[model samples]
Every structure is written in structure tokens, then in C-alpha cells.
Target: MTSIPDPVEGPGASPAVPGAPPPQLVRSPLSDGEWHRLHPLTPLLRGGLFLIVVIGIVFANLRDRLVFIFLPWLAPDIEDEVGEWEGAGGDPIDFIIANNLYVLAGLAVLAALIVLVAVFYTSWRFHTFRITDDDVEVRSGILFRTQRRAPLDRVQGVNLTRPMIARLLGMAKLEVVGAGADANVKLEYLSTANAEAVRADILRLASGRRLSAAGPAGALAPPRAGRVATLSQTVGREITGLIEGPEAPVTELESVVHIPVGRLVASHILSMSTLGLLFAIVAIVIGVSQGVTWLLFGFVPAIIGFGAYWVRSIVRSLRYAIAPTPDGVRITFGLFTTITEIVPPGRVHAVEVTQPIMWRPAGWWTVRINRLTGRSAADGSTDQFTTALPVGTAADVERVLRLLQPGLPDDERALVVQEGMFGPGETDTFTNTPRRAWWIRPLSYRRNGFRLTPDALLMRRGIVWRKLVILPLARLQSIGLYQGPLDRASRVTNVRAHVVAGPVSPFLAAVDRDSALALFDGVARGSVRAAFTDRTHRWAQEETSAPEPADLVRGAESAPAGASESAASGTGEDRT
Candidate 1:
């Protein structure tokens, strides 16, 4: 291969030298290697209890048989006595109860101790993890020997989960959520402080900060020690600056917003899941009264568990706040194992602001984003990193909008973005579902709407849970139009924007059929324009100024297709 001379480094050169071949990265070995073993208690904490329980159960079932067969031989004293019993009663259980009971108990205890020590020791010896500047790697398994690695840049998020026992012991498990599905790296049972420090390092590295593995025993240095000061120091410096006005230190990051604990608690209590809990309670009562009292045992435990989970989840999200950092947005929250994650700029793919019907009265909205990251949140409904704002006011929504896409024209927000989130009726800048749609979606028809802006296609829907999905034209992967039999009868079509896979693909339903066709054509054309004009996803990262979307149609080009007349005709109005 003809090797070209190294090109002068420019805007986006590879970190490694271009002309020279990249250095090969190798995994640390198993024994006498740089790889670090998990906390000594990890095996016991993870599986030792279960093994003990299993062994106890087996011992309980086989005690009499074991005593009958081995007791006489192992204990010569029992041999003479059991030989006498062979004449009195040949029953194994009788022998176990009379002569060999203590012996059996002793044997069981000894066997359990042996198995527990053997299993836990082996497990502890096998699991190992290594942190290099470029990647986090974990090697596990006794027989199969599985090794998994996640590159520092590809790590989307890191979760430090401390289970009930783990928390009590002040230990935690670190899960590095990666961009690729196969790149999950988990380091279980690190000291709580160590886990937190490791998580910070991962995020710091992912945010493009350099980390030196030349520290003690090849461990990455504490992220805050020298690279970045600890949170307390940062805050203290800010306070010190404010007091010494003349010598106020320059602040690198600004705290933009913080969610109140009271609001978080209330919003979680009134969440859509509250309705589900009520229904569950009602079902339990009805079922029990109807001679299905047996169901109470299962249903009650499940209901309690679900409620507890939600409560913890709510508490975890409490004290949620967003701040601007050099790398991107800094998200910090959590009741116990507080998390601090840096979402690098330009990574967000889609955005959704929604409010449940009950919550609308309270002026609360939840903001979530779709990023090019790992799987959806724990519930599997949305991306794990989706919820930027679990609950907030209109102003909060605006703040988030400004942060995500600052380049959007100012007129666009006033003309559509704000109103599209919680507006009523159609305007020159917005289009709503036809009146005929009310017959099919009686409660939500008035709220279903779409607005086209220079940069994004915004869709709003729902009465109980209001939703605004913002899909940037440049990020669109495909556009689709669908009409079922009922939609055809109602003379409406659904327009779906297929974006990158995560949570926030935008879909607008019950739009007038004629308008839908026109909207689809406009979006397809807009995407082509956006591809050339806007190359960067992050507004701040744009190198070249592309032409702004100058003449985006505010609404669909065509009007509703005789929607009122069709409703009056009542041919298929009540089909739904």
C-alpha cells in the first residue's frame, strides 16, 4: 500500500496520526495482569446468597438419606449404634431422628461452608475490569470467559446502581450504556465512592477530556483531582467570586435551571400511572369481593411493588437540574447515588414535550429527547436519556427548546413552537385535524395539529396527554403517509416522520387527506434543502452558514376535504 504523507491537521483530523498506522490496543491478561478484580465481596453479594439458599434446600431434602448412608461410616460410633437400630427399626427417618441427627446437622453445615467458599472464591477470581484511556473493558464468566468493551467516545451514559444490599454496604454497580447494542460494560461491586468517581471519569472522557492511565496501578486518576475540580470546589469558587466582587473569577459553566422537589413529587403523584394504580385498587377490591380472594395475595404484592418502584423513581429524579457546560449540558439528580452526566453537544436527535390531561390544568410539561445512544429507558417505552425535563412549566419548555436548537429563527418560536406545544385552534402558522375527525377522536380532534417551520416539522396531539414532537428536517431519515379504512372514510391521513431509532419519531394522525399529501411533499422537499444547508446537528457546531429556510409554508397547502359535509352526512362518522 502506498502511504501518503500526513496531511496538515485541520478541523476534523483523526486523533491518531493520519499517515502513521494506528497503534493496536490489547486487552489486559487474566492472571498477573493490569486488569483489576471487582471488590472482594462482589461474588458473595451477587450470587453467594442464592447459592447458599439452594444448598440449604438440597440439604434439607436429602438429610435423612445422607445420614442413613454415610453417617454410620463417617462416624464409627454411629455404626455400632445404628447396627443396633438395624435390629430395632430399619427406617431411615427413625435413625436420622434418633442417633445420627446431630451428625447430619454438622455434615450439612460443613458442606454448605465448603460450597459457599468454593463458589464465591472462584467467582471473585474470575471477574475483572480494566479502564484504559480509550475504552472501558470487563471480562467475566468462569467457563465461557466473556469480554466486553465500550469505547470512551461511544459511551452514551453511565448508570451507578446501588441495590438495597449494595447501598447498605456502600458499594455500587456501574453500567456503561454504549451506542452499540453489544457494547454494554458493567463493573459490579465497586465502593460507592469509587463507583461515583469512575462514572465521573467516564463522562469526563466521553466529553473529550483527556485521562491519564499512568496513575497508581494504572487506574485512571480521579476526574476532579486535577483535570476538573470537584463539585464543591467549583461551587465554593463561585461563592468566593461573588463575595470578592472586584476579583470575581470567570465562570466556565452557568446553572440554567433547577426543578423544585415539591413539583417533582406532585407531578409524579399525578402522573398517568396514578390512574393505573387507582384501577388496580378497584380491581383488587372487586376481585376479592367476587370470591377471588386468592388473587389478593398476588395483586396486592404487585401493586405495592409497582408503587414503591415509582416512588423511588420519582425520588431519584428529584433535584433534577440542567446547566450549560463547555462540553454540553450537565444533568445532575438522584436521591442516593446521585448521577452527573454530560450530554455532549449535537447528540440529541429528536425532542418531545408532553403533558398528561390532568397535568395540563397544572401547567406542567415533561421534556424528553431521542439521542443516538443506548436502548430506551428502563420501562422500555422511551430512550433512557430521553427525559431532559420530567416536569416543568412553559418557560422551562422554552428554555429547553432554546438550548437544543438555538439557530432556529426567533419568529419560528413565537409563530409556532410555543403555541404548537399548548395552543388552541388553527392559525396561519398551524393546521388542526378536520372537524370530522372529532367524530372519530371526539376528545382529542381539536388538539391534533401540525406546524411547519424552516427547520423542523412540529406535531401536536392528545387531550389527556398533550404531546409536541419536533423533528428537524435535516435529521429525517424517511417520510411516510398512511390511511386506514376508517381514516379513508373520515378523509384523513397520518403523516409519520421516520427518524433515527430511539424514542422521538414524529407522527401526526387525523390530518385532512388533501392537506396530508401537500404536507408530505413539502417535507420531502424541505429535507433535501436541509441536507445541503444544515450539515451540523448542533446549532453551535455549524461551520458554514447555510441558507435559512426562507419560505416554509406555515400550514398545509390544501384545505380539509369536505370534512364538515362528510360529518353532516354521517356515513362513517361514528365508526370509531
Candidate 2:
């Protein structure tokens, strides 16, 4: 691949315009106690949160806004307090009693409003995410300061979210995704313009070069924009593989799944605060007399969330396209606001075909990756990568998997899925079965369960949501050759496979241990052999492979007496 331009070394580069001394670095707002001017999109995007809270506050103080307007009407009813009695035309004692409380309440409201404005100002000035030549930096907080600097090498990709407000303003929020010390550190929420700049800068740094935008103070990148043609290409690619030839099959991909907006809205209404609901009910009663019914206003947020969700569902998933390119996998979609994410194929750790219960009949599956860097705020603090595939078909899944893990099984990219909804006796690459009284019934109705025996280990999950886990020798984290007291009579043993958070069998449940050692050695070797230097790609493609004897199930030895703790990471998400 040709090298990126050397902004520092290019001869034509604006030769330090032979003027005064080269400009020096300016102080950051954090140091100088000045607010850093942020992306213009910042206010509009975050304004949603404030607006939510503010509306509540304003409603809570409804009587206050209505005060002056109603004061004229209320004043005369107040025992002729201020105007008549306060002028000594009425009883002095009654006058004081009537007006004093009102005067004090008004004074109190003015104080509160002033305090509210100060808070809003400070909050707006605190959080910031900037792209630097070397890394992405987040400087946030006011009293107790927090600054995060994540190396560009640690950056996974810029996750762009166009919230309702961002859509209105043509802005985007950028997440600087990297594995934080505990999980992944993400510099969240940048303006659209700055978001693009930061994304480009990160990409530029990922390329192992300092961009001209880098100065003592990192320069803000105008949002790195993908061309409309580029987006169309990405769209086509998301449909097909870009980097890989268009021969791979799509596995667990869903092309068409109708979003139930009404259901979503109803669910939200059902989930609202009891107090809010009661208020709406009260407003309905008041509407019998008052022309202005507050009940109507109560539905605004639900409507907004409803619209936002539907729009997100439609636009985000609309004509969604995925393709393999020379650099990595590119995904494109959106009706009103377009977003395209390019993921370098090699950075992908693992790929999975996730079929949630709701998406089952619709044949929708979400394809997600455990990538190198970045996490969403939702999935704890670490990098959690996901591409919710509206289309979940085996063919789509295979195509995506190839892009994520190219050459995983080079023989053939597509594998026919064997039907075994009732039990675990299906394998595309190897014969899988649940013999030896191995399966644990998750729910009596569904055949999904955990299974472990000396011969082969598998976690059979799914009836409504089906998942079959077949852990062969190569995938075992460490074989637990143990049998519980009750299991002693059954003469069965279990093995646990430890896979890290990134790709490759992350957090799989139990599996038996026949022919596991071979599988373990093979996968471990595969990991070592697959490690590459280039670490980047554009498009991904298709291939189909059938089960081979090499996909063996290795039996495990009993667990060491105290090896239980070591198995925690590989155990089920249900801690109980």
C-alpha cells in the first residue's frame, strides 16, 4: 500500500510562511480555566437531556410561571392585600398575613432561576472530546477533574450516533473507542463537525502518521465525510462483501424485519413513572373545564422517543449495506442522516450470529464484533462493537463472518445449518450429539440447556432463542475434569473453555471434553498463526466450508479442586 503523505516533510506543504516565529502552542481551557469552544452540534445533541430535566423542573414550578400572569386575577381575591390593604385602606394585620407569604415566594423563585442558569452554563463547559495526532483526548468534569488520553492505536473506530437532535442539526456524536483500564475508555459525545475531524485524525493516526492537523494543540478535524458514492459503495458492500470477493454466504442476516413503533411507544408509556401517569390522568379530568389540557403535553416525550426510535430503526437500518473493501468492512445506511463506519477487518477479534427471541420469526440477527478498542457507555466501560443486522440469514452471517475473520475456515465459506431445534445433534463441520445424559434443561419447555460430559462439551441454548455451543479440543480455556457429588453416580465430567472478551468463543457456557485437547491445540495454534502484521483491510467476502474430522471434540480431565474461580470468566452471565 502507498504510504500516507508526510505532512511534516512535504516540500510543497505551506513552508512555514516565512513570517514571524512559528506559532506556539496555546493553553487549553482546562488549564486556563476557560471553556474550550466545542463542536456546534454539542448543544443541540445534549440539549435533549437538559430539556428533559428542564421541562420537568418547569412543570414542577408550573405555579411560578403562571404566577405573574395570574397575579392580576389573584391579587384582588387576596383580601385586598398589597394594593388596597397594603396602602392602609384595609386591616393591617390581615394585609400583612396575605401579602407577606406571596412576596416571599416570588423572591424565592427569582433566586432559584438564577441558580439554575449558572448550573446549566457550567455543565455545558465541562465535557470535551478532541482528536490529537497521537491519540484521542477527553477532558471532562468540573470539581473533581478527569482526563483520558487513549492512544490512536488503541482506538477501534468512531461510532457515530445521530440522536433526534443531532439529526435536526446535521451533527453527529463521536465515540473515541478504546479499552479503558477497567473496560474500554470512550470519549463520548462530540459535535458533528469536530466528530468528523476527530474520526479522520484517529484514522490518520491509525495509519501511523502525524496529520498536518496535529499541532501542539491538536487540530479539530472537520468531520471526515464519506462521499455519497463512497456511501453507496459501502451500502453495496454491506449487502455484499467488499474486501473479500462477493462469493461468501450471508449467515444469520435479516434483510427485512418490521419495527413495531406502536408497540415500542406503548411499552414506554407503560414504563413511565406512576406519578407522571397520574398527572396525565389528572390533567384529563381538568380538561373537562380547562380549555388547555396538560394531558396532551404529557404525551410529547413518548411521542419524541417513539419518533426517534422509529426513525432510528428505519434510517439506521434502511437499505443497510455491508461490503468487504480493501481496507476493512464498510457499513452504510440512513434516510435523513447518513452514517457509514469502516472497520478494518484485522482489528476484528471475533464474530457471532446473535438471534434474539424477538427477531426470530423475522429472521433477523445482529452481527457484532469484539474488536480491539472502544466501548459504548451502555455495555459497561469497555469496548462493545455491534452491527445489528436487520437481516439474519445464514448466508448473511457467513458473509459478515468472513469479513470479520477472514480465512477462518478457508475450504468453503458457507456451511449448511443442520436442523436440531429440539436437541444438540447438528453440526456443519462435525457431528454433534447429546448422549450420556449430558444436557441440562434450561426450561422444561425449551430444549436449550447446559451440557458437559467426559467426551464432548456443549451448551445448548435456544428454543425461542436457540444457541448450540460445541466446544472441541482446540477451544478449551482449561479443561475442568470434575464431577459433582451427584454427577459421580452419573459418571460424567465437565470442561470449561476460557475465551477473552474479544472475539473467539467469548463467555461460552459448559461443554463436555471428548477430543478437546486436539481442538484446543488447533485453535491455540490458529490464534498464533493468524496473528498478522498488516492488521487492516477494506472489504470482506464469501466462502463455504463443511465440517471436517479436524473439528474434533476433546475430552477433558476433572477440574482441579480449586480451579472453580478461574472458570468465572467463562461461566454463564447468570451469576446466581
Candidate 3:
């Protein structure tokens, strides 16, 4: 560990020279001006040479079979050889097959090996990466040379992924998830140790330090006080577990919450992915065993597709964890494609917690969020919103909730949050969907509702997978009201809240038309009030002083008595 160096008055202590280069946070991994190539194994790890070889071999086999079967037309001379074999009392088909098989196999193997070697060599020769003070650059491609650069400052976070094979070989891929869609840089197949070091170096550079103005010591400003623990510390704890006990508690440095592997597996089993995979497997097994070859055509593709999706989902979420950092909240997870995402301070737009009916008994919930960062290969495309936590207990949920919504009112925080999630219409100040909405969604109409808090907008929907979205009013971007033909006939409207790039933002579905407008008005008013309000994202900096519950109770009590009574009359009983 590098200790904090004592104060020293040196060249760096004085203001930088008029034209001198900026002080580097650390030495660049590359030479000042040299173009460095990637690890020699990059081609095998990332190049499509294996795919090319497989296709080449398949085509070779097909060509050999066609030539043997159609020799009479394809090569009229071969017909004479077949006729000679029949004249010598050997079957023509047998003669041709026996003589051609071995030669074709040898030629196919030779051709495949040659093509694989050429492609792999060409890819390796062209691929290179370079690190500089301001950016990390990667250049690759044989036919169409391409270069990608991620500026150190624009780099949001770094992801280090080790697939099962790569992990066994001590190799990993490092990705810098940049601020722009095209700026992201991926360094494929570096030694694991080098990847981790590069990640730390990149983060330190991106953190941007300055000399402390407070003290004569003039120490360099360190990175975030609560930065996520490094990969080495996290891996050390896993290794320590074998000697310590089964499932050693996460170290204080690693994370505040650790999703148990058992919970993760069980949650996955209960998900739609597992169901789809099971259906595909059953169909494929029955199709192949029953000799219904046509069924194979339909089920084979589904089986492969769903099986891949299932495996990737599980790989991407293994060892999921959320840790605090000065830059923002750091999320690290994945078994194979390990991803590290930093939700920078004040960047979160909204948060959603959902509990499926099956998980309700286990008290497990999945959390997701909306933030401002652009799409990333590590984070995934913009459409697939990353899960903050796939499965967590109510307490775990509360911890993450507080982390994401630091400005949440302190008093009755748990009660208020619970009310938002799976609470009845009367819980807190929630405005229930009118009974008339039953026509649109009979199973979950009563469950749809909204609650406007001083700091956030809470909306809940769904019956089977209860979804509760908490949109911090201060982060509200825009609000809209939609009325379909059915909604119009039913006198209902869907109110949607818009945030930056993410899965669909929070929405109140199928509420009474008048109530929807009123809700929209409330949201508009709340957004106006929250505009320009400086909210802190650091969890530690939030105010935690407890006030009387009455202070929060007032929010619920302030809900219009008439609306509450109207909802009460509709439900045939008061919900509270």
C-alpha cells in the first residue's frame, strides 16, 4: 500500500510552468510516443477465427459429400472409375464412398487449419492499444482499420470482465464506459493483474486531484473517501472464505451489501428466463426423442436462444454488490463479464423496486434505476436498464433505497417507503386508482396508485410483479399524460414521467381522467419546486436527525379528505 507522502516543496509544489505539461496522476502504461500492440493472445480471445473455422469445416464436409454423391454429373470421368469398380464386382456407391472419404477428411482438416491460422494472425497483427496522459486508445481491424479513444475525463467507469476460459487463463477484458455512445473503449484479453492495475490508474486519473489548499502540508487530494474497494481486496476475501468458513461476511472495504449466491440462483430460477429455457428444453427433448424431425426445426432455435440468454443473465449478475464512493455509487457484479458502474453524484433520475408474486413470500425484491450516463457495452444497451440489486431482503432494499434517495425525509422513512411498495392505497399519502379503472386492468386496477412526497414521486403498479418507482422530484425531467381509445372510453389516463436514457420511466397507469390530470398537476408543481434545489448524493452527508413521526404524518394527513372519502366509497371500505 502506498502511504500518504509527507509534505514536500518541490517543482510540483509550485504552480505549473507557463507551458509545462500537466502533472500526471501516475506514469502512463505506454511509452511517451511509441505505438504499442495488444497482448499476442488477443486474436484468439476476441477474433472470430473459431467461427470462421467452424463454417469452413462445415462447407468442406458438404462439398466432399456433394462431389461423392453427384460424381456422375460433377465429374464425368469419375463415372468411368465407378463403372470399373462395378465391373470388378464392387458396388459403385461403395467404391466411390470408400475411396473418397479419407482424402476429403484430410483436405478439409488442412484447409480449416490454414484459414484459421491466417485469420488469427492477421487480426493479432492489426490489433493494438495505447495509453496516454489524456486518453486510452485502441486500434484494430485488418480490412477496415478502426481506432477508438476514451478520454480520461469522459471515462465514467471501468469494467473488467473475465470469462470462464479467460479467468482460468488469468486474462481479462477491460472496458472504459465513456460518457458518449461511441467513446467507450474496450481492451480485450490483458493479463488479469494488468487489467486491474489499469482500472485503478484510469480511475485515479479521472478523479482529477489537486494540492490541498487547507494545510501547509500541501498533500495531494486523494480520490473519493468512500470509493469502492479494489478488485484485489474483493478477490482476497473470496479466497479467505475457504479457511474461514462458508460464506464469509463481506469485508467492510468491499461493499455495504452482498447478495448471497443462493438468493441470486433462486431468484433466477423463478424468473421468466428460467421458464422460457425450461419450455425450450422440454420441447427439444420431446421433439428429438419422439422422432418428430420437423419439431426439431421449431424447437432447436428457441432452445439455443433461450439457453444463451439464461446463461448470460446469470453470468452478468453473479456476485452483485453496491458500494459507496465519492464519485458516486459504485456497482460491481458479474461472474464472467464483471461490470463496474459509477452513478455519479446527483445523476440518478429515478429508482424502481419490484417484487414478483413468487418472491413475495421470500421477501425479495429487485431494484433498478434511471441515470444520465450513455449506453455502454459493459452496462449494456440503453434499452436494458441495469438492475441495482437483483434480489434483496426488505432490509437490504431499505439500505439501497436510502443510498439512492439520500434526500428522503428521515422520519417514518421505512413506513413511507413500505407504503410506496406493496402498500394499500391509503398508505402514506398515496392516491388510489379509481374503482372505475377495474375495466382496464381487473387484476391490478386497485393496486395502481401514486404518492407525491416533498422530495420524490412514488408510483406503484402491477399485481403479479408489484413495481414501485420512486422518482426524486428534484430529478424530474418532464411529465406527460396519455389517453388511448380504451382509456378514453374508460375515462382514464396514463401519466408518464420522463427521465434521461433508461428503460421506461415511472408511470401511473389507468387512473381516473380527472385524477390523472390532478396528479400531473401535482407532479408539475413538485418539479417546479424542486428545480434548482441542490440535492446531495453522498449517503453520509444526508441529514439523519430524527424528527417526530407527526412531521411526516402531516404529508399523509394533508391529502384531500374528499379524494380519500371518494376512494373509500369506491373500494367499499377504507384502506388505512
**Candidate 3 per-residue C-alpha lDDT over 370-480 given as tens digits, one digit per residue, 9 for 90 to 100:** 764545545545433357777888778888877777778666467555676758745446677778768777887777888777778778788898888888776776667
What is candidate 2's lDDT per residue for 8-79, written digit by digit as tens?
A: 211121223332111222112111211233543354445546766886886675443244235656544544
> Model 2 off-target regions past 4 Å?
1-36, 40-52, 59-68, 71-130, 181-191, 207-327, 330-343, 354-387, 416-428, 437-464, 468-495, 500-512, 532-576
Whose lDDT is higher: candidate 1's or candidate 2's? 1
What's the lDDT for all of these models?
A: 0.63, 0.43, 0.62
Kindly list the per-residue Cα lDDT of model 1 for residues 273-311, writing each as its tens digit. Answer: 888988889998999999998779977998989889888
TM-score, per-candidate, Cα-based:
0.64, 0.54, 0.64
TM-score of 3: 0.64
Error of 3 at 182 (Å): 4.8
What's the lDDT for residue 424 in model 2? 37
**How do the candidates rank by lDDT, highest first?**
1, 3, 2
Q: Which ten residues in a row have the lowest lDDT in candidate 1?
A: 21-30
Which candidate's lDDT is highest?
Answer: 1
